[model samples]
Target chain A: MRVVREIALHVFKESVRDRVPYTLVFFAVLLMATSYLLGQLTAGQEVKIIKDLGLAATSLIGLFIAIFIGIGLVSKEVERRSIYNLLSKPVSRRQVVLGKYLGLVLTLLVNISVMVAALYGVLAYFWFVSDPSVKAGWETPALDPALMVASGLIFVELALITALALVFSTFSSPLLSAALTFGLFIVGHFNADLKRFDQIVASRPVAYLARALYYLLPNLTLFDVKAEVVHGYHVPATAVVSAVGYAAAYIAVLVATSVFIFERRDFK
Target chain B: MPAIRTEALTKDYSTGFWRPRPSRALENLTLEIAPGEIFGFLGPNGAGKTTTLKLLMQLIFPTSGRAEILGRPVGDVGVKRRLGYLPENPYFYDNLTAEELLVYYARVFGHHGSEAARRAGELLDLVGIGGERALQLRKFSKGMLQRIGLAQALLNDPDVVFLDEPMSGLDPLGRRDVRELILRLRERGCTVFFSSHILSDAESLCSRVAILSAGRLIATGTVSELLAFGVGGWELVMTNLAAATVARLGLRIARATEIAEGHYALELPIDAAPDGLLRELTAAGAALVSLNPIRPTLEDVFIKKVGGARERATFHHGAHRDHREKT
Candidate 1:
């Protein structure tokens, strides 16, 4: 347990020193600023547009953090030969994998939180300063209740992506792992549509293949509650609970697979 | 008890596509290094020295046979805690300072607070990196990096230390320092198993040596035991030796050469010693300038063993082929 914490702390400090995290944060902030501007162009739907764009920015940036950083965690260790030092210690291979996973997850969590805070500040600015009568029709004023729920769902989504990256990193090179993880993230986001297409496809064999892929790929769209929050659609507590549960199961399976592969790999 | 014991250990790596050949990295190697012994594992490139070390360290699993450390299986975590390894061409995180790197390892090894700090300080000084503790490892030279690697390997004060080519990139002075460190570790009753291609280094430090060639243990024993494998002979430089003196001794002169001031080179038989012969030569009117015995070195023994095996195998195959053709 102490080994896990030590690895986590080392990774976290190293990530902070790296410019990648700060660059992503800056991009997220810029995204929020652009969304605010877009809200003005949409006129009466200013708050709704702001919430949609802000949530999208958060999820996108969070996905980038998870895939980019997580894929490099183990692959970089192997490339640098630092795995030898860590493995030569009393620490097990599983501990190293888990520690890296948790560390990257913490980084993504902090990044998502900061982006959400920035979005909240933007929403709050428009809600208070603008005249309610003039911008009310242009904006359905941002609701704190829906935004909080949306953030919770996004966290689950990011956690799942982080796990997916770790799973790919265990067997593949960093570049291939990153590319495949990013590709998976894109497919996961549209998994619902892929399932729908599977049903509509004319060929039976092709439909079976599509259906298989849909089941294998995580349905990331299920965790997107930004649309509900944007239109003032009530997000039931049960929906958030189910999404959290799904993410947990998906991450567990991926992390277990990673541990299995890591244990067998020869670090020569 | 042996610090490390391997019984018929073997490792094979597959190479070539479509028709793969299993290249044996270690083949039927059996060795037992006792506790507190500085054992030198020597071989040329691709001779299975590193493969053997890896098997002992449990970095990779062997294809067959068994290896044990401290009476435990190679992969046992309890055994690992008491073992420290410095690999060939070790690399560390470039971003971490010397102190940070050692502290990190100390923490992983379960040391903490002032104890960790004090140990880290002592190790940094021991590795001669006292002033450079705060500087990131990226700025360190190859020698400094090697020293830092040594520091980390000693972080746990392990009972056994496995160093692979530890002196590869070190300067002469750095090499001397490492030699001293290994000696010090031996004084502390730590078992040291290190591999080096430099025969002199192995000859100087190792109490016992194992020579590997073509993925096989060509020879294993003390230096003198290996040297004794090759034929021993004595060389005598004397002058004005009577034919009677030579005939009475029955000494076969392999080569008789005249030196600068009327000195003759007399190569005696393998088992004959010049101790008794020298006194006889001095008693005669002959001036015995020099009498030196020519003994085979470890290098010679290694070459002979490897070369002899290849020649014998080739000879057997050739004879078998001729017999088949005749049949």
Candidate 2:
């Protein structure tokens, strides 16, 4: 446990010194700013528009963080040949993977929080100072509850992506791992649509194949609450609970897979 | 008790996308290195020296058989804590300074607070990198990097140290420093296992050595043991006069070269040269100026055992030939 914590702290320090985290933070901030600007074009639906764009930007940037950074964790160690030093210690293989995953997740959390705060600031500023006619669309003057739900949803989404990236990183090269993780992210978001398309297909065998793929991929769009935040629709409490559970289960599966592959890998 | 022991260990690398035949990296080989012994693993490039180290370190899994350290199975985390390994070309985090890198390693080994810091400091100084602790490793010279690598390997104060080509990139002075460090480690009761192609370095540093050729342990023992076994003949340089009379003494004249004045170089069969040949030359009215017998070196033993292109050259020149071959 001490080894895990020590490695986790080391990973955090390493990421902080690297420019990649700061670059991602800057991009996330820019994303939130662009959403606020885009909200202005919505005219009467300014709060709803800002909320929608903010949530989407948060999720998108979070995915980028998980994929780009998480894929390099093990590969970076291997490339630097630092894994020899690390493994030569008393540390276990599982500890290395878990510690690295926690570090990347912590970085993602900090980055996501910053972007969420910026979005909240922009929405609050627009809500208070703007004309009553522009603010009339909002059911409340304060921050929307749906946007909070969306933030929670994005956090879970990013956790899932981090696990997927880590799983690919265990056995594959950094480039291929990143590509596969990103590809899975895209497939996950469109999983529901693909299921619907499968329903329209006539052949039962083809439908079974598509259904299998749908079940295998994460239901990322289910975690998306942007539409609820934008149109002032209430996000059911049960949906949030189930989404959180699903994210946890997915992360557990991927982490296990990563451990399985890493255990057999020959670092030399 | 042996610090490291291997039992018929084998490793094979499979290549090709389909119908791949496994290339054996290490054949069924067994050896034991005692505690506090400086054991040199000498081999030509591609002779499986690195593969053997990798297997012993548990960086790679053995295809068959087993290796153990301190009586524990290889790859056991408990055993790993007592082992320090320096690879052929060590690469470190370019962004981290020497102090930070050591601190990081120390932390991973579960050391923290002042204890970790103090150990890191002591090691950096021990490896002669104390003055450059604050400098990033990226800016370090090759020799400096190697020193830092040595420091990192010693971080856990390991009982068993594995150094692969530790002197490859070092200058003569740097090589001397590393050789001295190995001796110091042995003095401190640490078992040092190092691999190198430099015969002189191995001859000077190792108490015993194992020579590998094509993944097989061709010859293994002390330097003297190998020389005694493989060295076929010796050269006896004589002088005075009467070459025909000296030739009639039944010692096959491997070579007879005339030096200035009455000095002559007589390269005779080693077995015949030691049989009262010096007294015989003097009694035959040939004044023996000097009688020098040339012994075989480690390189000769290595070349003789591992017969390749170089070994063929050495064979033509005979075992006692002293033509210098670059390692």
Best by DockQ: 1
Instruction: For model 1, name the residue pairs that clash.
Output: A44-A138, A44-A139, A45-A138, A46-A138
Worst 10 residues of 1 chain A by lDDT: A134-143
lDDT of 2 by residue, B144-246 (tens): 8888889889899889999989997788988998999999999999999999999999998898999998788888898778767643555555566675775
Q: For candidate 2, what is the DockQ-based docking class?
A: medium
For residues A1-268, could you state the per-residue lDDT of candidate 1 as single tens digits?
8989889888876777665567566766676677657656756566776777778878777777778888888988887888887888888888898898888878877777777777888777777766767565752456566787888788888889888889888888999999999898888888888677755789988888888888899999889888878887788888888889889999999999999999888766
**Could you give candidate 1's per-residue lDDT for residues B1-327 as a string of tens digits?**
789999999999888999999888889999999999999998878889888887887767899999999999887877889999998888998878999889888988889878888889999999888788999888999889899889999989999999999998899999999999999999999999999888888888888999888788877898777777656677898887765666566534566656644456788876776677787788877887677778887777767777886687689889999999999
The list of candidate 1 runs beyond 4 A from truth reads A28-49, A125-129, A132-145, A197-199, A202-206, B17-20, B230-293, B310-327
The residue pairs found clashing in candidate 2 are none
> Which regions of candidate 2 are displaced past 4 Å?
A28-47, A127-142, B230-293, B308-327
TM-score of chain A of each: 0.90, 0.90
Best by TM-score: 1
Q: Judged by lDDT, which candidate is best? A: 1
Kindly give the stretch of ten consecutive residues in candidate 2 chain B with the minimal lDDT sum: B318-327
**Least accurate stretch of 10 residues (summed lDDT) in model 2 chain A?**
A133-142
Provide TM-scores for the models: 0.87, 0.85
